[model samples]
Target: MKRIGVFICWCGSNIAGTVDIDKVAAAAGTMNGVVYVDQNKYTCSEIGQAMIKDAIKEYKLDRVVIAACSPRMHENTFRKTVESAGLNPYYLEIANIREQCSWVHKDKEAGTAKAISLIRTAVAKAAMNEALFAVEMPITRRALVIGGGIAGIQAALDIADTGFEVDLVEREPSLGGRMAQLDKTFPTLDCSACILTPKMVDVAQHEKIRLFTYAEVEKVEGYLGNFTVTIRHRARSVDLQKCTGCGECLAKCPAKVASEFEEGLVQRRAIYTPFPQAVPNKPAIDRAHCRFFTTGKCKVCQKVCPADAIDYEMEDRLLTNGYGAIVVATGFDTHKLNDYGEYAYGKHPDVLTSLEFERLLNASGPTGGKILRPSDGKAPKTVAFIQCVGSRDKAKGNSYCAKICCMYTAKHAILLSEKVPGSKAFVFYIDVRTAGKDYEEFYTRAYEECGASYIKGNVSKVFPEGEKLLVRGVDVLSGALVELLVDMVVLAVSVDARADAKELAKKLAVTVNEHKFFTEAHPKLRPVDTQTAGIFLAGVCQGPKDIPETVAQASAAAVKVAAIFSKQSLLSNPTVAEVEQKLCSGDMSCMAVCPYGAISEQVVEERRGREMVTRKIARVNVALCQGCGACTVACRPGAINLKGFTNQQILAEVDAICL
Candidate 1:
């Protein structure tokens, strides 16, 4: 015999307007084992919960069913209600009548019938529910942060400040990411390096932080609170301990290649630091272009080094470490302008991407902050800035706004007018999205005070004519064609996911959206959390965002990692799979399908005709099992089963529904 109580919610006419609640409650009372039935206007409210609690006490109910909204919305709320009433939370089951029946049905009679069936199905499942307990696991008080960009730096610094060990890994030779390439930030017009370099220095000086530049995450294993990670440290060819920050080796190297930090706007020696102010300020040999590696002829860098720090035979190293949590802030890359051939990006020397122009504006750049035309070493009197070159265009396959382009474009225009006196600046845009604090005012100042022209349209084509370039487009506002000849053209390209973003996501066992950005656990509530616990997301890797947003998210992710490290132990999910040793055949089929590698084989003793026999059987590790139920289905025999979602309970619910 079982004691059951059924409660139906009107949801303040949200459910009652479509379904007859009174009839459904009456029908529920007739169901076997249902000792009491009641209806409430808002079952999740405090008063409604009181009524259910009183009924459980009055009827001595052991099982309870709540026919309310979707279980995703209120399952945890109702679980707490049952636990406070001195009942096991597992004894409760919810029937989503609002979303599954009432909301989808038009007729009252039909909706009530469907709701009654749903309640019956839930009641059947609750009658067979079993009590389960969570398993306690130990925690590791360490964190791993991927990417050495601003977001990763912020997260690592915050975590290390809380007295926990943190490892910061970057694939590049330098710590400063894209922010280091920029001349100035938007709105405030602060020097980018003035703000970013100090933080980079802080990371180097932090005692609890371990910096691993020129390294990448090779493999990840284990789950929340305990993860084993293997890192691949790429060879730098220069001894970090012996190398000094002198410019002798770089100046003496003969081989040169396009500098990646400068967006290919200038060339750097084969053995050179990414930037002058690079953290550690040490140079690494580019083996691909190095004359020594390529031809075994030039050892100019090795001979020029005063400390003899250069090594031609350095090998890549692999180191494995353990951590409690991980924060991913891999960052983003600018869209390639090959699809926008009309912009003449690769065709004309004067047409430059926004990133290229940013380097041109840098004080340490090739032009020494003069903003000279690349084709000719002369300053441009008239400069044209184009917006949405690879963004907000369906034909180009990218419809999402790059989010920071409009503000950065405005900053470029403002700088062009101030740097070159009497310079004419023309900006062509579809819409100026200045939606940040003081951003609109800043965009307005570019035109009002700076004497820049703001046009409303997309550039159709850019053609080179002598020293100047001709930009042709139609002004959507005036319905007239417009053409402008300018000395330089800067295109605001779209921001996209990094080239290896998807591959990294697979290695981490995290989910990414259609556009390859890492997906969050929840869009609004758990913005920094990933679907995989202990792993978090930060910065533009999650989506397109500005500096302020990236910093905020980075700090939020750090707080989450700190919270995990604060705990001495974590409780594993009780609904994980369990194995019946007597029935397991040890075929190892379950091990093949398990994504978490929770299933394994072990020897067990079984009695056969009064004689003890040692046989192999499958075993389940509850700590590693995520309870996806893939192993249970793969088992040919009924040897494995999920704790709360047992086969008997599911079959009973099916029988009740069919009846």
Candidate 2:
């Protein structure tokens, strides 16, 4: 029998306040194989760890049960402590009494009873624990970054500066994302393009970085330190080397389509760059709307090209590369407002989303920076801004606040006063959140100095009253009806995780949250890391965040990649899937369910009644296995098992819990 030690934690009254720690400790002492029992105020502290180390040596404890917090939070800490005491790290089991029992149960008797049961289960599992070893895998020394937005660009630059090779893939024809669409930033109100374009250029000129625009990650395989990625390069239909960006093709193209970068405020040529300051400074043919590709007749771009760079027969190509790590910074998408018909969106030409209004505020916009209503070629003297339009409303849209809305709305109100003198701005908001540094001051400047009115309410409806908009709502603060007649209405729409975020998550084998944002490994500790090893997340793809926070996370993810590349080799997780070849039926069911592609079929010769016959059996590649235990459940013969969670250990724990 294994000599198991149980250490219950008071967690500084977090657990002891609700549960009877002495009763739980006494119960642990009476459990089978629990040779020693002790309690600690904070089991994770350095002093508490020393006590565990001394007890392991004094009592000759081979296995330990810690009645504390979740293993996800402190499992590695306790494992290292146990390992330093000359014991296998896997020999330690963490029973989460605080979160599961003490925190949930207010009754002292019930909480103590649950804590005792949890400790008993841990002791039973610890007794059956076995020693496990980790294997070393070689590092590839290269990194891949998905999405060429500010986050991706910043991460690639940081990694490249660290003297490691980086490959940046972007789905759009240009490197700039939603950041490029904005006219100005909050607080400082600096030109967004002026600051963002320089970084975009640096990414293009960096020696260690290779930029691949109009491309997307098609597939991802392998594990940490060695990942194989397949990228699909969409056809640009213009020779990158020969094109001189002379704007001849853009001016000559007869076909016109709504410009995406301009938020569909104006028409652009069928073959054109997203913006004039595009990183590549080149134009791409939109085959869906191109006259030559659709009708198969007009090759006007080819005839008008000064460098003869237009290519009519370009096809999409697939290329695969090896990367040590991957960073996802795909950014976010704005709410479509399909369900918000009450706001008169898509019905009135004057009613616009925040992004569409941002384009109108730009000097390069369709009306040359004039805040003109789309209904008529005239500037609006009065405009009403609605905050949290599809945000913080469970019935309408997302339940989380789009963090940048309040500050940016204030910025819009201030900009309106500066751009058009004598213009009035009205802002409707439930609550103005100015959490960042100097954010509160900037918001105050809008209403105090900029002659902008701040209304405290949600707009109930926006109806088109002839050439103007009539906004109707109640002032929640004043308990009275409020109405405004304005030339235009701007909806401060919320942001959502990219529509295709979950699709990309599946490809990388990373998990996403209920809101479709990529889930971090740990929200507090591993904010930039994804659940998958060697894969990290940055920007709004993880959640709604401002540019500064996104850039910080991108740099943090770069450091993680640098750490991986700096290491000669990494120790693979010891607890991986294993298969018993003797009981193998070669059903290949385990291989089908494995997300990591860790399981494969291998032929082995076996003796059956003195007859040597070759049979195919499932084999597990430890380097690729992440110990998810999916295959163990899928195997009908029960031959496959995860190392630390074998059938015997789990059944022993179940029997102990029932007792």
Candidate 3:
């Protein structure tokens, strides 16, 4: 029989003010294997800890129960004290009396009775405890970064700079990603390529970074500290070592396709680079649009290239790599604003998205930085910027603020005024969300200093008339109806989930919120982490964020990876389940009821190498198991038993406490 000691805490008016702590301790003292019972003013206090440890030595107790606060508060502290007194740490149990009993109940007798029941339960639980230890496993010190956008690039660079190798996988042909498509970063007005292309070149040239453009993540398996990732390297149809990027093949190629890098604003040849300053300085042949793929007659790019880099026969290959950690910086896609009929998104030529405006104002864009209306190629005198088109609307099922719209929209208004001098720019927002440092001041400067008109209202409708958009809205604060005949309408749409974020989360067995963003372990403490260990989340894929927030999270994820690598190997919790195959009747009763999928089938073989048939046997993956003991109760054959909290230990403690 296991010797049990029960200690109840009054918690200093927390429990005793409501329940009778003395009677509770008396009831616990009468319980069957319990050799001692006492009430402490505060069980979690230093004096109480000393008394408990001294009593353990005095009574030669094997198990201890504390009826006090929640286990989340002081379970570890008491367990450490027990270990110091030569007792197994797992033999300790905490009964939540203060919150779950005394504080919630109005009747003192009922609360005390409830506290007694809880203490009895803890003694019953602690009597069955067994010693357990953590198992250690080695970890590989490498990382895999999904997506080649700013977030992914920043994470890869941070991890690589910390002396760890990084495999950067980008689905696009170029490394710049969505940042390469932008004209300038908001509020700063700095050239996007000037700041971003340098990082691209650095990634391409870094010894620790293995850049794989035009690649996609096919599979990811294993847990933290040891992950096996399979990446599909799509055939670029051009050899990097041989291609000179001299534009000779691009000039001669006859086939043309829409330039996805420009968001279909311009056209490019079948064999061409994504942009002028593409990293690796190579051109890829678009097999879908190439004439040779359709008719097998034209090899214009191959024949024209002096270096002969084009290879039509190149096929997709799967490459497997091992890494210790993973950063999911999949980024976000813009919400399609065509759903709302209030804005003529696709129907009117003068109404455009913020991305389209970025191209129109870019120096390398189609019009060479000319702010011309798409309808007639004429610069407009008045432009209206609409905010919250697809965000914060219950009809669209997106209720969260996008977090970056205000700052960027203010920047757009200022830049548009600069692009077309003497032009008037009006911004309509549901509310100006400038929550960042110096962000509210920036918004104030846009209105007070730059003379940009800012109004608090939602544009109810937009219609086209003679190459102009008629925007109508009423300012609720000013109590005035306003209508503007603007030459162009730029909708500041909200940032949404990446097109493949849901599919990727499903593949990784990670949870995503209703907004289609990846869910973090905790909103505050573990912001850059996913619930799955070793798999960290960074940037807008987790939520709507600005560039600064994305970079910060990327660095945070790198810190987590570095910490994981600092350990020689990870330790597994020993409080896991164990199965006895001999007692199992092969009826598969425990296998069907177990939620953790710990049970499986095993074949028993004879000594003469004869098959003994397959039987449903239970096995536990100890590292993933939490040792809840539900399987032990469900097993009809009594084959399943938890290691640390065994059935024998629990019943012994229960009998002692109930005596």
Candidate 4:
């Protein structure tokens, strides 16, 4: 019989107060195949680990069962302990007594019984365990960064600095994301573009970075250390090689469409660049609005182009490349105000979203930095800023703070007072959340120094009054209803996940929470990492975050990519599914159920009597299999089974537990 050692941890009062540790250890020593049993106050501690290593050497134990906390917490720790003791890591099995038995049960008798059963099951599994080794795969040494926003730019720049090739893909024509459209950032009030534009230029000039503007990541295949990515290069109808960033085409084009860069505050020519300091500075023809595409007659851009760069017949091209890692920094979108019709957003021309107000405050915007009312081109003397429009409201389907709204609203009030002399700025907020560096002081300055009125209340409604808009709300602090006539009303709308976030999450096989924000591997420990290895998350795509946090996350993701590239090869998980060729029925049932596409058909030569015959059987690719064990249950003839969690091993455990 195989020799097994059982280690039971009291876990202080966590397990000992509820379950009898001595009785459980004594019971385990009598179990079949178990040669040694030891109890410890903390088995994961250094002293307990030394005891385990000494016992293994003394008892000549080949398999070990640790009845302790949940495997998620210390499975890897114990696995390493076994490996250090000259034993295979896979030979170790963990019984969750702390969480499953001790913590869950109130009665000591019931807890002791469950703990013994758990330990027995673990010992049974340990007895049937076999040694397995990891498969080494080659690394690609290249990285792909999605989104051209500040996060992606920073990640790309950092990875490129490590002497590895990086492909920076953007859906927009420019490199700057939402930050480019903002007037100024919070607290410090530093110009957004002043800091962001230089990085955009750095990404453009970086020798190791390839800028893929007006592109999207179409498909991603392969596993960690090696991935094949297909990027769809959308037709810009303008050749980057031949075109010089001249204003000839823009000046001559007849088509005028709403500008996305300006948040639809002004009109832009069909043949236009996003902004003056665009990375490439080249213009892309908007095929939807361009007269050449809409009607065969108008080719004003083509005719006016001095370089003859416009290509109306240009087709979208697909470029496939390889990468070692991918960093997703898709960013976020402002919550649409459809549900907040009570604010009269679309109905009233003077009522604006925070984003719209940001564009208005920008010096390059339609009114040339003047905060003018949309209904009438006049500057607003009184501006009302409303906070938490679609945020922290269960009725609107969002119950989380937008995080940046409170600070940005404070920023708006401060800027309003500075830009317009004697302008009255009134802010209505449920709560002022200024919990960042120097943020509270900035909010205090807005009220104390900038002469802005801070009202603790929720805006009830905003309707048209004679010449100005009337904002009605109750001052919660004063316990009085207040109505003020304001020239312009700005709603601090909620920040939400991008519209296509869920679709992209499905494509990448990454998990997104109920808020549609991409879920990280671990919220605190693995903030930059996604559940999928070799893929990382950055910026607001993971959750609502400020620019500082976004940049830090981007750099962290870049460091992860650099670390992967630093390694020549990666070790594949040994717990992946394995196929027994002798038991194969030539059925593809295992292939049908595999979520990661790890199983495939392979031809094998089999001896039938005295002759050899070729037959098809399911083959498992260990690199792709995440050791989920779904293929194990799907096989009818039992040809496929996970290496660490084998059929015999699991059955042995079931038998022991039932007995």
Q: List the residue pairs that clash in candidate 3.
A: 31-656, 31-657, 31-659, 32-656, 32-659, 33-656, 124-654, 127-649, 128-649, 128-650
Rank order (by lDDT, best first):
2, 4, 1, 3
TM-score of each: 0.81, 0.80, 0.83, 0.82
State candidate 2's TM-score: 0.80
lDDT of 3 by residue, 1-659 (tens): 88999988889999898788878878888776899987889888899999899999999899999999998989889989899998888878888998899889989888888888888888877766767776786798999999888888899998999889999998877787777878877666689989999999899989999999888999877767777888999999998788877889988989999887766677998887888878766788888888998778899888888987888889999999998999999888888775777888888888888878888888988889899988889998899999987889878736888888788888777788788988888999888888887778877877876778987898999998766889999887899998999999998888889877778886665778988899997899989988777889988999998888888998889888888887878887677777787786666676666544445567664233464555555566665455677878888767788886677767765674475
TM-score of 3: 0.83
* lDDT of prediction 2: 0.92
lDDT of 2 at 498: 94
> Would you give me the overall lDDT of model 3?
0.83
Q: Indicate whether candidate 1 or candidate 4 has the larger TM-score.
A: 4
Which residue ranges in model 4 land beyond 4 Å of their true spot? 1-123, 578-621, 628-641, 654-659
What is residue 103's positional error in candidate 3, in angstroms? 11
* lDDT by residue for model 2 (1-659), tens: 88999998899999999989998888888889989999999999999999999999999999999999988889999999999999999999999998898889999988888889999898899998999999999989889999999999999999999999999999999998988988999999999999999999999999999999999999998888999999999999999999999989999999999999998888899999999899899999999999988899999999999899999889999999999999999999998899999999999999999999999998877777778889986888999999998899898799999999998899999999998888999999999999998899999999999999888999999988877899999888889898889998999999999999899998998878988999998899999988678999989999999888899999999999999899979998889989898877999999888866678889999899989999999999898788989999999989998899998899999999999
Which segments of candidate 3 are over 4 A away from where they belong? Answer: 5-30, 35-74, 77-87, 94-119, 477-480, 576-620, 625-659
- Candidate number with the higher lDDT (1 or 2): 2
